[model samples]
Target chain A: MTYCVAMNLAEGLVFVSDSRTNAGVDNIATFRKLHIFGTPGERLVVLQTAGNLATSQSVISLLRQRLDGEEANLHNVDSLFEAARLVGSTLQEVVEHDCGNVQRQGVDLGCSVLLGGQIGEEQPRLFNIYPQGNFIEATRDTPYFQIGESKYGKPILDRALNHATPLEQALRCALISFDSTIRSNLSVGMPLDLLVYHAGSLEVPQGFRVKEGDAYFEGIRAQWCSGLRQLLGELPAPPGDYWS
Target chain B: MTYCVAMNLAEGLVFVSDSRTNAGVDNIATFRKLHIFGTPGERLVVLQTAGNLATSQSVISLLRQRLDGEEANLHNVDSLFEAARLVGSTLQEVVEHDCGNVQRQGVDLGCSVLLGGQIGEEQPRLFNIYPQGNFIEATRDTPYFQIGESKYGKPILDRALNHATPLEQALRCALISFDSTIRSNLSVGMPLDLLVYHAGSLEVPQGFRVKEGDAYFEGIRAQWCSGLRQLLGELPAPPGDYWS
Candidate 1:
């Protein structure tokens, strides 16, 4: 299990992902799910993955593996859409290669990715790529995509995120969403990888690698807890014989 | 799908349930999930059901029919635990009678209940009854149980609830939990039935019916949204280039 989220806002794109993976409670380990690809000013795309670790990592490696000589790649993709296509193609290839063996062992090749960033003159964009290698781009009406352990955290995003939100504000929303996921699920843990890309900046974006004890995340956790209690305290109790 | 939560708190107990029932998105209807028995000072036992509506309704009907007999029934149970046993026994009876027919169509029997209340000198108690008729009492550590569409609302309870929490405060927590569930899931909707019981108080517990226009709920919803944003605003942003 994992929790990864990416948002495309007016100011930029925001990506947040947790770094915990477990086969069983005793087999827990840290694995960064966010993969970054860039050529500085030319392009900057990030892929946040969830589902079967082997499949996701295989897809990522296939996406980055050199294809002989000069050929289309995330590094040289002309548009964000093309970059998404490259990811989709890679996912399909990886699934085709691995699904047969996985099926023999009674495992399903389940994997998905949140792909987002900018390339050349194209506007910042985001997409959710499914296991079948098909994808859906984020639209103005729905400006974010989340993969894995999504339900626990979805309410915060449903209420808070929009296409016009500022970069920092979107970051805040993503963290709250992550906070919700972490509390309800053991599969999503600390050492978060977050990226905030300013639209059109093109160059490598600013972000954080948030480990446990990271001051900012600790503050967010404590404040959210306190704020929820405070807000709940302010709500009016039911009137006379309300439950009678 | 449904969302029903019951809490065993220091003050007593609280149970809230959404009434919407859906076989699919196109097939949805209103059906009350809370069942109340007895009057003030006699004994008050409330049952909140979630999961397969037919199975739950069957259990309810069975319990009701038992009440029509001259001997034992929910109203005549000597204690809250005995009332829970009656509910569980009734559920098993319904399953025995209907499960074979239901499973023939490839649908498994599924239903659960949050049974809570006071009877005579026995302190107020709450139990989460499973589909198999087995159940577990809420403890001081956890103190609450939610069934169906639970993940979206679980974090609120994880962060806000405890056995030491006052009944009013716990009620607010339950509402916040319900609010989150309603926001994320179409299957869980209003109007909500909220019941609160005071510890050792052998009186008819208070009940609050929250319709769409319910002012307190509206205020809580708005305040929670704003409070979450405010809390997020207060957290420090992650450091630049930490992900590089």
Candidate 2:
């Protein structure tokens, strides 16, 4: 299981993901689900992966290997959207070549990818690429995309995320969302990867590998829990007559 | 789709279910998913149903019809745990009698039920009965059992709920969880049914059909959304050096 989220905010894009994978309860393992690709000051593309670790690794590997090709790569894609399309195709190719035997053994062939970044002068954008070759771009009203174990962490994003949300604040909310999920589910764990991008920077963003006992992450998690309990306590209860 | 949640707390039990049921997006309908069975102060059983409407309704109908039989009916169940087993068996009977024809037509014939309340001298308990006639009881560590669309509303309960939580506070949190699910999902909607049980009081605990424009429900809905926003605002950002 995996949980990966990407926000396309006014300030820029933010990406975060958990790094735990398992074929079964007894065979759990840690694997990186976030990948970064770019040329400094030119373009920065972040790809967050979920499902079928082998497929995800293959897709990212294919993209990295393409950097040396004369063909379009993350560095040379005409636009961030184009880069997203390339990712979708790359995943499709991997599935076609690798999933046949795996699926015959009753394994899932599906994978979900969230692609976010800036391409030259184009505004920062994000796309959720499906297991198939199709994808959907995030717009202003819904300027975020999440893949895998998404439901547990989605309510916070749906409620608090907006186009105008500051990058740091959006990152904070993502951490809160992650905290909620990690506490509720064992499949998603610590050592989270978070990348903060400032729109138009077109360079590697400030990245954090949040491990267990990371002071700031721990503080936010503790404060958010207590603060929520306080807020719930403050809310007015339904009147007696209302129920009667 | 549906969202129904039940909590087994030290104070008592809480059950809430959205009324909206649909065959598809175009054909939406309302149906009661919460059912009550009790002999006043002796035994009170609350059953919250989810999944196929026809199957769920049939299970409830069978249980109601069995009240006149000589066999162990809900009113005569030895304990709340026995009542849960009864519900599971009744569901299996419904599936046995009704599922074959439905399955031949490619329709699913399963439902999930959350059964919670007290019986005689036994303490209040909660069980999540699966369609296969197996059930799992809620424990101190996990005091709540949710059926249908459980994930969206789960984080809040995961963060704030404990076995020792007061009934009213738990009620407040369930409402918040329902509010989150309702906002994010089109299938789960207004006109929710909520039942609040007081451990020893039994009988038909306070029941509320929270309709659209119900002042109290509306108030909580509004207050919770804004309160969450404020809480998020107060959480401190990751330290500058933390990310570096």
For DockQ, the strongest prediction is 2
What is the alpha-carbon lDDT of model 2 when measured against the actual structure?
A: 0.87
Clashing pairs in 1: A242-B207, A242-B208, A243-B206, A243-B207, A243-B208, A244-B206, A244-B207
Summarize candidate 2's per-residue lDDT along B1-244 as a digit string, tens digits: 8999999889888888999998889999999888988877788888999998888898888889889889999888788778888888888888899866778998888899999889888889999999898999999998998889888899889888999999888888999999889888899987988888878776766588888898888888888889889889988877875344
**lDDT by residue for model 1 over A1-244, one digit each (tens)?**
8899999888888899999998867889999899988878788889999988999988887777853438888787788888888888888888888877767888877889899988888888899998887899998899999898899999889887889988777887888898889988888899899888888888786557888987777887888788878877877775666656
Please give, for every candidate in the order listed, the TM-score of chain B alone compared with the true chain B. Answer: 0.95, 0.95
lDDT per residue as tens, model 1, B1-26: 89999988888888889999998899
List A-chain TM-scores for all predictions: 0.95, 0.96
Off by over 4 Å in 2: A241-244, B241-244
| Model 2 chain B lowest lDDT segment of ten | B235-244
lDDT of 2 by residue, A40-83 (tens): 88888899999888889989989998899999888888898889
- Candidate 1 lDDT score at position A138: 94
